[model samples]
Target: MNQQFEHDDDIEPASKSQLKRESEELQALGEKLIPLDRKQLESLNLPDKLFEALLEAKRLKAHGAIARHKQFIGKLMRQVDPAPIHALLDKLAGVSDTHNAWLHGLERQRDRLLNDPKALEALIGEHPDLDVQQLRQLIRNAQKEKASLGTPKPLPMKAYRELFKLLKQFNPEPPIPGVLRSDDDDFDADE
Candidate 1:
C-alpha cells in the first residue's frame, strides 16, 4: 500500500507552462468570437456575461480597453465548458476536413473550366439554373487574360474568381441528415 501511494505521488500535476498554454488558447478563442456577427456569436451559446463582455469588447476602440476586456472574457471562459464553443468555431471557420475537401473540389472545377472549353458546356448542362451567356462571357474573358499575360507576368484572376463565386452560389446543397448523397451528384463528388 505504501509503495503504491508513493508511486501515485511520483506523478506530477500539470505544469504552470501547460496551464498558461491552456489560458492562451482560451484567450485566442475569445478573440475569434469577437469578430463573429451577433447572430453567429449567439449561436455559440456563450455564457450571458461573457457574451455581454464580448459585445463591449467589440465596441472598444482604445487598445487598453480592448486588452482589458479580452482578459475578462478569457477569465469568464474558465467558468464555462469550451468544447462546444470550439466545435462551433471550427464549423464556422470551415476548418473541418470535409468542408476543406469541398472547397478543394470547387477549386478543381474552376481549374477545369479555365483549361477546357468543353468544360463550360458540361458545367452549364450540369447546372441549368446558371445563366449560360454570362458564364460564356466570363470564360472568354478568363481565357483571354490567360493568353495575353506577358512572360513572367501572372494572369489577372478576376474572371476566375467570379466564376468560383458563381459556382458556389449554384453548387448543389449537401444532403441533410438521414438522406444519403448519391455519387451522381453534379457538384462535389466527394459529398
Candidate 2:
C-alpha cells in the first residue's frame, strides 16, 4: 500500500515570515536594475538642461509626486535620448495617478480659482489684459517664476523661462513668444 504524503501544491502556504524573506530577495533584484545614488545619475553626463530635468523627475519621484515625475520624464524623452528611461516612464505613465493635482502648480491655482467663482472673477477683473488663455499662461508663469499673485508686478523672462520649461515638458509643441515691436532693436527682450 502507498503511504500518503502532502502533495507539493497541497503544502501549507508560506508564513508572513517566509513571505517577507521572499520580498527582500525580489527587492534586491529590483535594486540591481538602477543605481540609487545621485552621483551615479550625475555621471550620466546628460546635457545640463536634461540633467536638471532628470533631477527634477527624481525629486518628484522621491516625494511620490507622480505628475511632475511624468512631466519631467516626457520632457526627458523629447529633449534627450528616449532610449534609457522610456520603458520605465511608459510603465509609470500607464499607471493613473489620483494625486497628480500638485504636479502642476498652475493647475492647482486654476482649480482653486475655478472652484471659487469670486476669486476667478476678481483675477479676471484685475488683469484686464489677460484673456482666459492668457490667464492660464500667467498662472503658469507665476508658478514657474515662484512669484505670488500678490506680487507687485509680472515676473522677469528668466522666471518665465523656468515655468516655460515646465510647461514645455507636458506640451512639447508650445507657442513661441513673438518679437516685440520696440524702438530698441539692439535689445532682445523676451515677452
Candidate 3:
C-alpha cells in the first residue's frame, strides 16, 4: 500500500522544456500586442499595471530595455487568464478582414466607373443618393490623369484619391455585429 502511494507521488509534472515553451508562447502573444494602437490596446481590458508596463515598453528605445520589458510583460501575462484577451484579438482580426474586403470592393467599383461610362449609370441606379454630375466630373479627371502615358510628368493621384473618398461617403461598411469597434479602424481610411 505504501509503495502504491509512493508511485502515485512519483508521477512527474510538465518537464522543464515544456514549461519553457509555454513561457515563450506567452511572450510571443505579448509581442503581437505591442503594435496595436492605444485604443485597440485599451479594448483588451488588460490589468492596469500590466497595461502601464506595456505602454512603457512602447517608449523604450534601447534594444536591451525593450527585450527586458517584453520578458516582464510575459511574466505579467502568466498571472492573468488569457482567454478573454484571445477572444478580443480574434474579434478585432475579423473586423480588420471585413474592412479590407470593403475597401477592395470600393476599388473595384472605382475601376469600373473609370473604364465604362455605363458603369456610372449603374452606380447611380444602385446608389441613388450619390451625385451623378460630381461622379462624372471626377471620373473624367481620373481618366485624363491616366492618359499621360507618353509624358515625363508623373501620374497625379489626386483625382483617384478623391474618387475613393466620394465612394466612401456614398457607402460605408456596416458595423460588425456584437463587437465594440476601436477608433483604429479609421487608420487606413485614406488608403
Best by TM-score: 3
> For candidate 2, which ten residues in a row score worst on lDDT?
173-182
TM-score of each: 0.59, 0.22, 0.63
Off by over 4 Å in 3: 1-16, 43-49, 60-68, 78-100, 169-180, 183-186, 189-191
lDDT of 2 at 157: 50
What is the Å distance of residue 44 in model 3 from its true position? 4.7
| C-alpha RMSD values across all candidates | 7.8, 18.7, 5.9
TM-score of model 2 (CA atoms): 0.22
lDDT tens digits, residue span 54-126, model 3: 8888899999999999999998888766655665565556556666788889999999999988989998998
- Cα lDDT, model 2, residue 144: 49
lDDT score of residue 28 within candidate 3: 80
